[model samples]
Target chain A: MSEFFSMGGYGSYIWGSYAITAIAMIALLLATLRSLRNSRIERDQLETVLQARRPRRTKKAPKAS
Target chain B: MHRFAKPSVFLKLTDPLLPWLAGATAILIATGLYFALFASPLDYQQGDTVRIMYLHVPAAWMGLFCYVGMAICGAMSLIWKHPLADICARATAPIGATFTALCLITGSLWGEPMWGTWWVWDARLTSMLILLFLYLGYIALVNAFDDPERGSKAGSALALVGAINVPIVKFSVDWWNTLHQPASIVRMDGPSVDPSMQLPLALMILGFTCYYFVLLILRVRLELNERRIRALQLSGMFDERSDQEAEKANSYDAGHNAEASQ
Candidate 1:
């Protein structure tokens, strides 16, 4: 309703405050999620490369009884 | 406490907590918004403008709470050299800075209509501005050095010293004549605000607190992964160098054998 939206002529201030709060919160959530994802990818890539570089150990032959 | 100091154990415990905290935050914020917009009665003096208090006050509270939390973590890291404490303190800086910014912006928006001014250098406002600067400074100091340990040490020291501002910000209105009003919700007498208003305010504060935890867990995990990556890379570099040295020695031996046979 227009009445609710108007907030008795204090609509701009009320809406502005809520909007800014929402934006800031959303932005923070997105940034944190993105950073987490990026770091995970980077860690995975590094792990794979390190695994490939690792030297394989050969099995020892059994001794004659 | 010591059990969780290992990042792997900390992650295992907190990974399960993140979804639950995030869910609670969503529910609480929704309920708070409903009450704030529809259920709460308009203030007799400030009218609908008082609605802004639900957002502004909670954010300001969170800003202070996060800073205090960061300072405590800093102290723990400094005294005991707790590995996870400095990471926690580092992770907290940006979240606290965001909340402080939200508080300042919302307060300014609320002020323009109520006080007929966008800003004023009153005791409370100035102290809050200083708090924002402190958070920014802490974040910058933490990342300024090539050695992350040195950066953490410097940042922890700064956080401990800057903690003096937290109490100042809290008591500024009482200490000096300021345009900002004295404490209403937290006081010796009790909350002066109406029960209807208090409900939404409490909900919002709790929602924000849960939200902070959710973000903290995520950021801490990111920091741990970063440290792991750095360690792996360094070890990988050392391995490559040793392999090259072995190859060089073998080639030299082969050439020496050829010269002897000739």
Candidate 2:
């Protein structure tokens, strides 16, 4: 109801605090997730590249047979 | 503890706990918000304006909590040269800064209506502002250097020194004739707050704590992955000279100078 929104005439202050807190928390969470995802992608890419470059067989391979 | 400090082990231990922590954070915050806005009664004195305490107090508490965590991690990294501790300290700075800023801003919003002023040079407010600056300074100092190890060393030193302000912030109201009210929930005699008001306050504090751990885990993983990628790239750049070195570095994060720092 409009009465609750008005909050006995201190509506703006109450709502403002809640709104900003919500926004800041959400923003930080998204930023953390985005960076985490990006780093995971980067690490995976490097890993695949390293795998391709590594030797396919060990030094103690099967004798000529 | 030392065995689990290895980056790989740390990640494995924490990754499985992430979903549960995140779920708890979401649930606690939602319930806390409900109680704060609707279920709890308005203050006879301050009316609806008291609702701001739900956000302001928790943010303030978390701001201090994270700072203490950073300082402890700083000591661990300094005394034991724990790379994982260094990563944790670095990951905590931004989150702490965010909460401190939240506390200050919400406090300001509440102040304008209650005190008829938007700004004051009170002890509590000023020290809290200093805490925010400390977080910002730590983040900048840590990332300033090309050598991550050196950055961690300098950053941890700063964190240890800045810890003096946490106690000052906690006791500022009692120590001075500040406009800020004295502690109500945490006191020698026990919480003076009403049981209903305490419900939202306690829930929000727990929720914020859960949120911090969830982010700490994510950010620590990010830092570890970045370190591994750095080691991998360094090896890849000089692949022709020593193929064996590259292979060694490719053993995941083992290339991060896992020192025998006993």
Candidate 3:
């Protein structure tokens, strides 16, 4: 087990490479997912507001076909 | 290909594919890691340190892969004025930059123990650094303009220009007398790597490619939604009638898409 970890004295380099790769990949994924979610939420909110305002009619409003 | 320029059509096709691509990415990466760490044999020359090649090689490949994909998308955007292509080019930049950075970092780590130095101005290394800068420059240029259309145009130009470096980076080792070793996996003859080692490398490369697609899909969708929000903001409705207001908004959305695509 220890031999596997030390990797014949090159453990730090090997482990560091793998660890950083994992972190960077995960970070990019999370950030992209978060941006996607935020944009989706913002668009939905704007569309909802637009929808609510769409039904609003003035007293003198003409019938819209 | 031109039909894919429609955001609705693109989204409809890709939305169903996201889950499946993400699943493939996870499975491939997990299995690759297993092979890389435990299943593969150590290099007689470098000992266990060759494991670094598993991550390093894949990251480098992705860096180049994303750049080529971006360049192709940029060309399509320029020739066809497809907003989807522009969005794809924009989406690919940061991911490409991240992979390039990973390549440099992992190479540095591997180099310290093997090459006895932390840095070098070797042909391959220097060109890779340039590739990272190119990605950064594209990101900055696209966002620098106030108008998205102008930004996309300027960015497409830069991407097309920087594409000359792709071939240069690929052949830098062959062209120069550098300390960096010549190509082992991709040669005119064939891959010179051992079969056991090849398994991990191939798996990791495929895993990384799938991961790229997953991120690409999400980012493209994000850009499409943002475009809609912008169009909605620009086409504020003053119509009092409910039906007309809805109609006006839909028309504005359609007009915005049509103007760019035309």
Candidate 4:
């Protein structure tokens, strides 16, 4: 309703306060999520590369008679 | 506890938690906003101006809560040298800063209509302004050093010192007579607020709590990965050293074998 939007003439202040707060909160959430996603990918990639670089151990056979 | 610091374990623990927290945060915020904006009645004293309380109060609560969280994490890191504690403290800094900004901004907006100005040097507002400064100072000090360990240590010290302001901000109106109102929601007696006002306020607090959790988890996960990268880089250095050592040993053995045959 227009009443809800207007907030009885205090609409600008009320809605502005809410809107800025909401945007800040959402922006924070999105940024946090994005950083988390990026970190996960980085961790996975680092794990893979480190695994590949790790030394492999193999046993040597005894000399033939 | 250290085992949980491992990225894999952290990831596994957080995987199930993220969805639940995200969902809860969404529901709480949505419901809270609905009640706050649509269902709650306007104030007689301040008309719709009191609506700012729904956002302002929660942000103020979170600002306090986060600083406490940071200080506790800082203590853990300093005493135990726990990596996760350092990570937690680091991750929480920005979140606290954001909440403090929200609190100040909403407070200013509320003040403009009620006080005929956007800001004042009142004790509560002044102390809150100081709290925001403290948060910014902590963030800056934490990242100022070239050595991350040194930075974390310095940051912990700053966090502990800054915690003295948290209580001051909470009680400033009581300690000093100021234009800012005293506690109406939580007092020695029952809350002075009406049920209609209280419901949306309560919902906003709940929603803010969930929001903090979501942000905390995300930040913690990011910090863990950052540590993982550091560890991998160190491990790479180790592998390179081992490769060179093995090459040297192989060449020595080959030279001795050739000499013995000759």
TM of each candidate vs. truth = 0.91, 0.89, 0.89, 0.87
Candidate 2 chain A, poorest ten consecutive residues by summed lDDT: A56-65
Best by TM-score: 1
True contacts kept of each: 0.88, 0.88, 0.85, 0.77
What TM-score does candidate 4 get on C-alpha atoms? 0.87
For all the predictions, what are the DockQ values?
A: 0.77, 0.82, 0.78, 0.70
Candidate 2: residue B156 lDDT (0-100): 95
Q: What is the lDDT of residue B137 in candidate 3?
A: 97
Where is model 4 more than 4 Å wrong at Cα? A56-65, B1-4, B238-262
How do the residues A1-65 of candidate 1 rate in per-residue lDDT, one tens digit apiece? 99999998999999999999999999998998898899899999999887876743111112211
Clashes of 3: 0
CAPRI band for model 1: medium
Local lDDT at B114 for model 1: 90
lDDT of candidates 1 onward, in order: 0.91, 0.91, 0.91, 0.86
Candidate 4 overall lDDT versus native: 0.86
Over B1-262, each residue of candidate 3 has an lDDT whose tens digit, in order, gives 4355567798889989999999999999999999999999999999999999999999999999999999999999999998788999999999999999999999999999999998999999999999999999999999999898999999999999999999988999999998888999889999999999999999999999999999999888888888888876664444333435667778888999999899
lDDT of 3 by residue, A19-39 (tens): 999999999999988988998
What docking grade applies to model 4? medium
